[model samples]
Target: MYRILIVDDEPMIRKGLQKLVEQSELPIESLRTAENGVVALQRIGEERPDFLFTDIRMPKMDGLELCARVAEMDADIQVVVISGFGDFEYAQKCVSYGVKEYLLKPVNIKGFQNVLEKLIRTKTKVSSETFVAVTKLEQWASRMEHAVWMLQEAELKGLISEILEELQAYKLKLNRVIDILQEIHTLLHQRLNVRDVYLMQGELELTGAADEQEAWCRFTAAVHGHLEELRAKRKGKLKDPVEEAKQYIETHLAEEVSLEEVADFIGLNPSYFSQLFKQSTQETFVQYRTRRRMEKAKKLLEQPQWRITDISGEVGYADHPHFTKTFKKYEGCLPSEYRQQMGIRT
Candidate 1:
């Protein structure tokens, strides 16, 4: 199903054409009408209709001019020109702008039917290609998720090699590949406690490669490096309860976690765990949690997209004012002031 927009100067013609399209039994999902090319351009921006039925001449911005503008924008919109004239020069102009169909006014029903059928067939073929693209991306995402789990288990060498191989297998466009990797990066933070505060927020801009193959190389290298660091941490000789506690805190930073909860989780008495944590980490549980939250706030401040209030809630302070007060105390400045000093602009 596709959306269609009908553009014309006359209300009667626009309504009539819309009715004809509705009764044509074509695969059109919806129909829209605009009085002139100017309004149609606005409709295109808003609705992004798949097909446009436009008149050649109109009061403000003729169809040819609209087509020219659309071509400059490089959007994937199919256009059919509706004209009162059957002139060869006008048809040539329409062809130059990649108009799919040029229909004469007082449209012949048979010709109109032929055009609709052709459009439906073309769209169906494109839809098939799109389905394949989506399926391939889904497979890539699944592989990346498995890789993250392997990282959590510290399967360092084998998992790293497999991840690089999987990156080579990616069939999607570079931008789509980047989006999937970013999603996986977020999962890495939540699941594996791979918290590079700067990278977690939008501080690190992953540069684009010359092509998909180059992109795969760069992306896999970065992932391999991050995982290697985690693997090193996991390769410690002695089991460290304090480190485990820190990992737990990072994994559940947004949740309402408590000292007793963490202590019980690692099979320790709250009192003894409290004393040990303070001795080892040199910070009380409450103070450590506040430090983690404030550090998270600073990282989030780097991302211009997130609101300060939203970052506050994300770091686990329900009340914005309370988060602000705590952030100021911890960072020696307000969150906004900190962001400004760090040269982050919204």
Candidate 2:
């Protein structure tokens, strides 16, 4: 399936290309339209298209500049330059930036199909050689986001390795790899309250990487170290009251515990405890309690020996109907359904 992006300042041209492609017999998986190179670049970052057909003159960033950036970003993308008679010279210069073909103004359906067919042949050849689906690329982004959010160290390491392999497969430039790593760093930093905890210059520099192997090694090590530090910080002091409160919650998850009970146990006033819990755990007292209870319920449900009724009571629910309802609300499945999905036979 072909993924194409059309970039032109004129809304009519963009829509025209989109409509033409849709009506054609070409095996187009998706077609995206952009007003200018700026939006085009953003879309490329999310998922690089197989073919990019762009006009020469644009408002924010011109096609020439965009082509230059794309050359550095992904060399595999097939670029076709769109130009009028007056801009032929400028479009000619775009050839050096890896543009495959040039389309003159007043685009004809016949010429469009010819150029598109040629590109499709080339795209198919390349795909036969080494094809990576658009969905797989998008999945990498989603997996990376979740790994970073949960601070799953092993999962993060594996994802970083997979990403490096993909970049290597595409043969991206050193700067492009650096930019990708920086984007991940920005995501991680935004999720945490910590400032500049990512790999900065004078700490662990990727710019000085000797080769692709060194770059991947240095990048992963630096990020892993930073994550370790952040994890340690979140662990806090051993005797911290917040830590004690968390332990208390874990220990008494089978019992109906309240904010007042935990607060008194921790030797703090209920109001102060509520505020501290929210600030530290990023959730209200009731929310944290319910989330923990549901987590425990799910864990117990994994064991085939544990009945749904027993698991519910073990996670603090007294009534079977209420447990089923709560479990369905939290997990989008009833307790039995969840266990069945987990491949647990009663």
Candidate 3:
């Protein structure tokens, strides 16, 4: 259903157009009218009608000016010009503005109907394109879900060669297939698709029994039902290592906490853990720890009992000036100002 706006200085002309449109079988969802170009502009801004019909001659502003304004704002809207004179210059101007249709004094119902039909057809084509794009996106998401489920459920090492062949036959990207396989291999602690593994006696040809198939089905069902839960658990575990690293920082706030030491405690390479921690929380591990320390500093500053130096050391700063700098960077104010704002003086 398309929305339409009619603009004309004459009330009779506007009413006539509205009646003719309302009588038509076209699926016009809404129709609005304005007495002049100024009012039309206001209506257009408010409603953003799909189609516009305006008379060439009007007080304050003419049809051409209104069309130009609408085009400047949103070129997607379709416009039709109506005029009392059969002026070629006016028709040329309308053409320049990309006006869809132009009609003289006595409007021809047939010509108007034809233009309306064309506009509706164009709108329908655009809608179809949007639907196709959405459909493709949904199909891609479903395929990814299926692939993840399959990799997590079965011990895919025995079926690697067959799976590779199937993926190739399905025209799946080689890189994507390899990445999925690598993730499964890492999590399951097995060298997938290795020549030695496949060549081992009875490894390649080990077929699952009916009981095994049933178990596989149950496992697949559980995975599908709890994939979101499993993902959350994995994310939580990823955070635990970072949390443990943070504990050491809390215990020795006055001293520096090296990234290497934190990574070693969490059984991860320093560079990789730094990258992973950033990816998970959208903050560098160092920055996050600094923020945590600053928050603690702020809370400690609220207490009248703690001295600035003591508070600074308690939150992991080796020097009072350094703590003030870090606090200003994170809190947008000096530590002393922050303490004052919190009604604490020491």
Question: What lDDT tens digits, residue by residue, belong to model 1 across residues 185-272?
Answer: 4544454444332232111134433445554544454455444334434565245668988999998888889998997776554654
| Residue 282 in candidate 2, Cα distance off native in Å | 11
TM-score of each: 0.44, 0.44, 0.39
Over 4 Å off, model 1 = 86-88, 128-134, 144-346
What is the Å distance of residue 89 in model 2 from its true position?
1.2
Q: Write the per-residue lDDT of candidate 3 for residues 1-346, one digit (tens) a residue.
A: 7789999999888888888787677787789999888999888656567788999888998888888887665334778888877664675587767786776667667767777788788767654543323343344334434443444424322243343444345332222233233343333222222323221110111112123233233323322323322333444544565567667767766567888787776565465456556656789978877887888888888888889999888887767898898889889999889888887775
lDDT of 3 at 205: 12
Candidate 3 wrongly placed segments (more than 4 Å): 86-88, 129-346
Pairs of residues at least 3 apart in sequence or in different chains that clash in candidate 3:
253-316
Clashes of 1: 0
| Model 1: per-residue Cα lDDT at residue 320 | 91
**What lDDT score belongs to each candidate, Candidate 1 first?**
0.69, 0.75, 0.63
